[model samples]
Target: MNRSPRFRTSRTLACAAALLCGAQGLSAQSTAPAAPTAGGDAPATAVLPPVQVRGHYDNDIGTSDAASEGAVTQRLIQNRPALRPGEILEFVPGMIVTQHSGNGKANQYFLRGFNLDHGTDFATFVDGMPVNMVTHAHGQGYTDLGFLIPELVRRIDYRKGPYFAREGDFASAGSARLALLDTLPRPLAEITLGQRDYRRGLFAGSTQLGESGVSLLGAVEAQTHNGPWKVPEDQRKFNGWLRATQRDGNSDRALTFMAYDARWTSTDQIPAALVENGTLDRFGSLDPSDGGRSRRISLSGSTRTTLNDGAWQASAYAVSSKLNLFSNFTYFLDDPVNGDQFEQAERRRMFGGELSRVWDVTLGGREHAFTLGLQARHDRLDPVGLYRNRARDRLATTVEAEVKQTQAGVYGEWNARWTPWLRSIAGLRADAARFDVDSSVAGNSGKASDEQLSPKLGLVFGPWQQTEFFVNAGRGFHSNDARGTTARFSPDGTESLDPVPGLAASRGTELGLRTVIVPGLQSSFAVWRLDLDSELVYIGDAGTTEPSGASRRSGVEWNNHWVLDDVGLPGWLLDLDLAASRARFRDAPSGSDRVPGSVDRVASFGIGYAPEGGRWFGHFQVRHFGPRDLVEDGSEQSSATTLAYLRGGWRPTASLTLAIDVFNLFDREASDIDYFYDSRPIQGGPAAEDRHFHPVEPRTLRVTASYRF
Candidate 1:
């Protein structure tokens, strides 16, 4: 019932598309090649900013020998609206987050045409502690991020791919490092009054408690909404965080106490018209008063100590999380008798802790950054399903599962500044993880554990201060649980479970170049190949809707950001940001190409205007996502989509400011999201190939006003 287009056929088509786009890009460039700016070719030396690991700025390029890129970047954090790091760089080149469940679905972003897998695609690190759980794929990525107020984040560095010493296992696609600043003081509050009795407000404050590095911090955000789909955003969010630390005057040996809480609840579900007709709200939706609620809370802390004559830093951290998800779903079916409606409830609690250390050892004239860390987590997931039968009898089935996993790794990276122009980092890690899953279901229940040794190596060459070339090779590993093949039956009473899902493993290689045309201009380009052999995705159970398989994805990405003609344009400045990517699968073990569901090729461009160091600013952005398949059945072709947004912001003084956010500029056609898996069977059968694209959200606008003192 399912006919797979030959790999060659799809690849040939992809190649043609890439060629066309490449030609168009070339045409867009000015007739004359860009001339090197004055002082752009400075000699490379200690004069240059340190070349750090992916997504890290404050952290030195110590022994953290990353498997891939070492592109040093500087991001301007001013006159911009950024709720989270993802917001500011959401439009960054070489990256995309095809999100679902609204923006709160923090973990559900897609990057480089790869699924965030909830939070598995990229792992976040604070200092040296891992924020993503070993049980990521299906669960929450932030886990308890709501508790950590984003307002407290000083800087965030995001990187994708290749292993390095500073990071550990599960850091496959990439990683992010968040550095929290304690001395900075930002106090502010804002309250908004809107239509449909909608109201929202936030309050935050931070101060240095003492010179020894003791600090106090607090923040809160809240929202409320009543929807008619006209002003369709009935949601509420709150976040609070506090911290205290004592450090030696030399900035070493620090003991810190950290605690935070984040909770978001929304009662607005995607409207019907908003899903199909992104441009119209023709008819009143079926249920305008229905929606969903999501809440998550977390708390943790860490202690860092310096030993061995200032040659080492050691730390231990622990985090706990609790979450709730409630959804009321209504939809009309076209098949198996049509007219189907449902509601579901899900609750989860996960708690764990990790300890990590970094030892800075000086051997002769070279430095070695050695890392040994271990993480243990206990995840208890409870999923309940309620179904209505043909006779209108409501039947309920519950799935209770508890999973405990312990992961520990040892890594050592040696970055040799072998020459003024060339540097190399070679590192290796040995990781062992064991999973214990206790599920109420019988035959599908079992325990599986695996250990792996991942090797990472990278080389960077700076021909000139403005240019750097790099290469990296590393392996990625993740485990899968056997939980989807339960006794829950479909509306048609089709039994599940044919082939048990297996574990997933990956290995990849990447090469890239980053350069600065000048202090204010930056650019990067990378080409990579990933070999993913996945039995079950990290986000879902194996052998569920679609069969799992081995897959290969390789792509090229180019990115650039420039503060063009800054001095020439005066108050009117033009900054350009561009991204382009293309992907092709050399082999898809499963006949279906949906093994990895993400857009194959995509691009985005943004132009902005702002006061050099003033308070008010705005930007106009154009985002384009190339057409691609999500379900591999009949292409599941989603037309390429484009969206636009604008903002008017002002900061009257250092402590007070206000702004407005307008999304879907022209009310472009957009989708909320489609159900990932259709009820269609996976085995070759009459129903095997039937699938539908989940609907997407419609044009929406949120007016925001803020003040800081």
Candidate 2:
């Protein structure tokens, strides 16, 4: 149910006040780390002291199944400086997050040599609830992380490739699972101010109920910003969360509610020629009216029961979301009189549930384990549509439709420790989906169904000298838009369109190594390859993704984390990640084999000093994304991008802290993202092919102050 704006405001304020009051007189304490669920075979959770102390990752050496799988603790997360909530994903090695539009929208993502536009091919979850939306108005698997409150995130578990049975759709490239903290060590309030009129406020607290094993947590956040663009972004956002958890003798359960609302004016990409010839400023907009508004509210619950040497977990969630987006990518290409501006809108309601059980047994003096899981989801979209617009007013309807989609999947896996130094994992998964669409055009109304089966395997060798080797192979799939699977007419109803396949398949293989051979150092490396039956590309102008030719991508990644304490420099940590890949169409001619927008190299380095019981802490980091092919023939290429950030803070007391952050420390002029395409920047002018880019913001600073009771 949707609440009135006034109601939302009142509730937000009430929650904020309640959180502050609940935190009074409560002594601060360190939060205990929880064990990972057996469904994923995750390792134990470990961390250093949490009172403003940073810790290096120490969970992947012998307890992990793959070199590319690991967990990031909250301490590391808190130490990092993130300009936007989505940037938190950067903690995943070799992943790059950028933005081409407003900060309130989903950020663009790149990984494994593929430009995963707005989260395609990557599955993301928050507290067991899937973040990727299928049959979305903007694109398939559109994931928006703006609603996330960075301070509430506890841990991020990530794995690369499609070698795990627990991961389902959109897992071909990788997956990231964000876990929210059940409680905070202390009730806290924070405020921040920055350049470009940026301002934010946050309040959060947790308390236990009397004599019962029940606890409650509440948080609220508000933010506003006017970016450095000629046309101010004028963004406003509000978020709220409430959760209650209970611990029984052998079972743990929790229920959570989350709400988010935001609106912003976008500074979309501009034509390169315009900026080069001084026709437009680097931070300028061709259409100032382009913007969007979004709203989402969700309720979810989860339960877990721990048995002797085994576990059972189950979760259910329901979400209601709406989006009204206006964009003008091609200034005047479609209609010279009214311009090419248009709107994509949708109102969606979705619900899903998951069940899994894991059990261990000893047979013939050998240890063996088995896992079984079931998953199902349904989505109902009312009045999902597209329309031509001049400014923000609709001029003509392109297409309007209602859709119902349902999907279900089941998986089973067997793990065996055949020898003291060897193990094997094998799994199989089957999924099916049905889509029904009611369209404004008769030819586009129909029903379609499809299914897929995937098999997976993994082998692990000896952990000789604190090092382990792994080999994995698997198949994964991503679902297409429900409308695309049955449509026979284009959005304009002027041309006949052939329906695309409902599901696209992918196969992946990897050889990996993980080691802690060097004291204070944890390292992992992987060489992997992925082959897609059909490549998916997002079409910005059309607000949808299209299936392209088959393609292949191969890459290698190296990740390292070091705690300087072993080297006699306590409280210092260093990290480095490097990746390089090659991507091409499988059947294309030699000259045209290159995949457009495929990144070839990426790297990041960071050093942080936050000694235990220290009064001062600091962190500095740098990231680089190598140039990429902007066109199929490789004639056009994008420029490499490099950025630096710094953060320094002082703790004046046990309950008070202040920090300052500097972004783009070098003030470098670079593009956040680039596209080579045809556009008409002027009315009645011929469309010309040129590079379009979104420039990065200039060097900016932010100051934050926080207090705990």
Candidate 3:
């Protein structure tokens, strides 16, 4: 790596000037004020202004329907070291985020024994807007968070089961909602530089509207990186955000706009034999042309009003996005002439809205709460297709189609407190969807419709000793890709295929406990099980639906958060989370029940120290992903992986801070993801079966500086 003396000097001077100005401001504020006089100015006495505390408690253990519901606040997000924006989801216990391709693509997510390919069973949202793309070209329920500006996040609320009436679709495994701050305490500008030619810049600010009860917030970000690959990644990205909020008494409304664009070259997974035989280095690529480009623009608005008894809320959003992905998974295997390269492309527009009302009442001397909600969404995708390509030129069109999808859902829930230590929640939801696809191949064009009714129930007992026990059960479902729902033939229109169900149902149950009995400690334990009606999915790569037997998964999770204020180490925090699970095909033969790629164990630990009025802060964290069977018969398995990270910061003044982050701190050699497959590297050669993997990045360091105005 080379250094730019001019850039370094400018940054240093800016930080120094900001710190100097901040110190002078602090000194002026510390000066004594005029004394207060009471009644005729007799013996005036100095009176200090009253201090107002501002900050909310972190919800490490939530008091909701399920023990798995919790929240991560800005305090934690600001202190953690994340190699990529999507890693923020790691705040969800037992959740692992890893990338198998380029930074521009959606990271692979695993949780509770489910691989959740590209956010399939796990739903994600940002500021009332959904991030998951339905009927996506790459995969169903595809989610990308690269557009997120982490500094704007206020909090992330997460729940690990489908036990709530407010959640629907792709939420069977879990859901996460990220909220952005409506205002900032001050304007800030930050610059970060790291190994492998990585650079990023961020600018954000907020201001009040004069006497209008309104506020405006704006942010912009630019980033570039050339990863340590045989062929440079050359990732470039830009993001922008704007929000306007109006507040009046107990009511508030906000309108937000966001935009993001990114382009990058990728190094897809490689054959293990190639690396083992020294034919290619771990950082080598099978195809240098593998890459992708994506963009998203959205506008959303939300409003809340306090009603006579409870509250009313509503939100709506519209988004437009485009994606062009090029991948070469098995070179010379499928198409020897074209080298097996393929492209997936799509252009889509989506609109959605949600409305809800909550009412509070007392019945028979007991308090009760009720909520009613409705949600609707629509997606119109044009020219979604798959094609064979050589280099970057398309050689043949496999499947090309236009799709329209619409969904409507409604639900109602009631919560009742029967006794001081007993509570119950019951809910029911109904959803209906319609899918229409017009394919370039006439035989595959068709329409399909489906509906489902889901019931939910939860019971809570005891707060005795600051511990609560919970029992929850719920039914949920995820919509299949529109193409899968209406397809009559394969991509080439040669082989006939049966259309899959429009919606696949899942049911789950859990028993859990949460405790805050120990001082400065919050902990939770949960044992859960889920069953899917069928393991059927639309394979984007092959452009067809594949059906499998029913499946079941059982898991246990334990999460703990402890603060060490009483141990003479104020502002020190520790977090530990562990999870284990078993996934099996319910209908499989006795000797082959194991589900492929289902991880059995996961763990994460973190420790941080950030004392009040101190000039320094530091954090260290470790994450582990245990091995798992690679096939239904359990003949092959993957090896476990562990990685560590360290972050430290020095606040020279109230308005200036410098930070450094070390990733893969121990220089561990590991794989981000792995799969077992057969491929032919040479024309007319016998196919070889082996484990394919994407190696994780080696040790890297990043330094950042921030100035506040």
Candidate 4:
């Protein structure tokens, strides 16, 4: 399929988005203030309280528009013993997070039967800053979560499908928003030690700003680790953040600054045949010098103020980040003499902002709400490049480019309660974007533009018997890499190529139910189907995404959160999540409809005990992901993976605590990640297709001590 710039369509959508923003701004000025309360004073807007770590579950049944939407509080995040920073996302039902290389790199994510390689179909945000990078050197929509400090996260709000008006690019499958804490109730100092030369330190505190109604919070962490690899990882990482917040009668405001830096050696996946034949160990590396370094710093601010019978919110952020990564996916396939090691590098700056307003009005003796929002973002990459390397030394340049990408969007939604047992929500969104690239190869330098308009609808019925039913449908999209949107030739200039569409569209529908029929238990189930206009696959050799055939995926999910209080165990909680999905190409021949790397089954079970005023707490968890096809013809497949984790802690006094964490508790010899591709394991050997895998780490234990003042 050939895709060209749609000038007229893009202009029309851009104008529509801009006009909607203007109209909403004008209407908001005429809204009247809410009436005074019984005490003859304006009511204060609801705000989230300060962060506290305890055994508490947030209730979302009565407040959610969809059964697949929920919030995870600090209680769950603090109690879980995460081996990697990105593991925090596992709290989302049916979501899997894994790593194929170094711990400091972006994680491999899978959800809803889609292999969301490096966050293509999943959008993520930290505070108000977007975490997905556009047109990155490594891949499209590359997301790195190493900068996040799990302890500082107050809550994580997640929604599945594209049924929300507030979400835009990269949100076809789902989205997550992480909110940070503004203050700490008590200052804390901690130290941790483990085998394999692991060590870490952390310090955090909060204080008032001289009675100015402003509070200042600061935190810093440093860590080092050497994995169980033949070549020690020798990872070093540092993270720090500072935030200042002020809350007045009807307004809230905050400013935050964050910085992160890391460097590490990676143990890339090895050929399975070699490992099986004893030519290489499971934890061995073909290239010892393969590694990466990254740096990120950002400043952001947000404000929320009461406006008439509603609220207004605004946020803005600026970020500067850089990455230098080196890898050898195909050791000697491309270059038998020098070995096929390559480097990907990028230096980029990003700026973005969002403005929104919500109004609550009564119509015909019924409650109704209307919301309008506008969002804009810009990214500038001074130099994004790919190079051929040998033993960490650059041998030649493949491609280099300077690119700029900009996007703007607007959405409006209306929600109304038709009756005591019936409700409806309807919404529409418009988005537009422009991509410009100046490449070293003149044939690949050009400009392109595109736009899209999407509609969303949801209906809810009946709380009869403590159960609610829902129906939802929506449209969403993800942008392709800027370089791919205008490229006319391959990086090596040896073959011609075709430019891909700037944006690929997706449509989704879901039928779900939420119930609390059993006391102390919350259960939800959803059956969903999603269709894509085009599936963009990552091309490792060219460092870009190439468009593939259209595809369809259907899945079912069951999530349960049970508190054992009513069962005579007041301090115990059990959680179980199960999902199964089928994915296939829409128009593929027989025996080739299967989508590679799409797992069909995922399950997780966790239990924890944390009673109020208790001196001891413990949590145990098990996770499993079923096998998947590795090729179109299903000629090869991957094995299933399962692991267990244990966490236990004791409080020695009111201000001191001790904890122990065990990962891979059963010593399972599973693989963290796997792939099937052509490579030459030995120099000057014939290229052959085989399985490649990164082995899971062996069982490990860590101990931590913390003091609060």
* Candidate 3 lDDT, 1-709, residue by residue in tens: 0112222322332333333231101000000011110000001011111111111125433345678877776777888889999999999999999999999999999999998889989989887778888899998889899999987777777888878777788999998888778887778899999999999999999888899977888999999999889999999999999988877877767778999999999999899998999988999987889999999999887776666776666677789999999998888888766688899999999977676666777889887778777667789999899988888689998888999988777788887888888888888988777788998876888877777789999888887788889999999988889898878888777888888877789999999998988877788999999999887788878777887778999999998888878666687888899999999999999769998888899999998877766788889999999987888898988889899999988989888889999999999999999899888766676678889989989999999998888
lDDT for position 573 in model 2: 90
Q: Which stretches of candidate 2 lie over 4 Å from their true place?
A: 1-55, 537-540, 543-545
Candidate 3 RMSD to the correct structure: 12.9
Error of 2 at 13 (Å): 39
Task: Kindly report which residue pairs in candidate 2 clash with one another.
Answer: none
How well does candidate 2 match the true structure in TM-score terms?
A: 0.93
Off by over 4 Å in 3: 1-57, 60-62, 683-686
Candidate 2, after superposition: displacement of residue 608 in Å?
0.4
Candidate 4 lDDT score at position 129: 76
**Local accuracy of candidate 4 as per-residue lDDT tens digits, 41-112:** 111121222222332445435656778877777778888889988988998889999899998889989899
lDDT of 1 by residue, 1-709 (tens): 1112122222432333333221101000000011110101010111111111122222122212222232223233333333333444353344554444433434345566565555555666553345665443234244224334444455555556745544554456666655454433346677765444556676766566555455555556665554334535445555555544445533332223344333333222333334345532432332332233445444434443444632222343444444333322333332244223333333445544344444555567654444444333445544322333222223433334555544445455554555556666676765544445555445435555455667877776764756777788877665444343222332234564442222245787888777665644555677887776653442222213343566666777766555544445433333333434433344543445553456666666665665455565676666666665656443555566676666676667765556675556787655433343333221132332232332333444556666666
lDDT of 4 at 71: 70
TM-score of 1: 0.75
Model 1 off-target regions past 4 Å?
Answer: 1-78, 82-92, 102-107, 126-148, 192-198, 208-213, 226-233, 251-291, 305-311, 314-319, 326-394, 482-503, 538-546, 564-596, 612-615, 672-705
510: Cα error in model 4, Å = 0.4
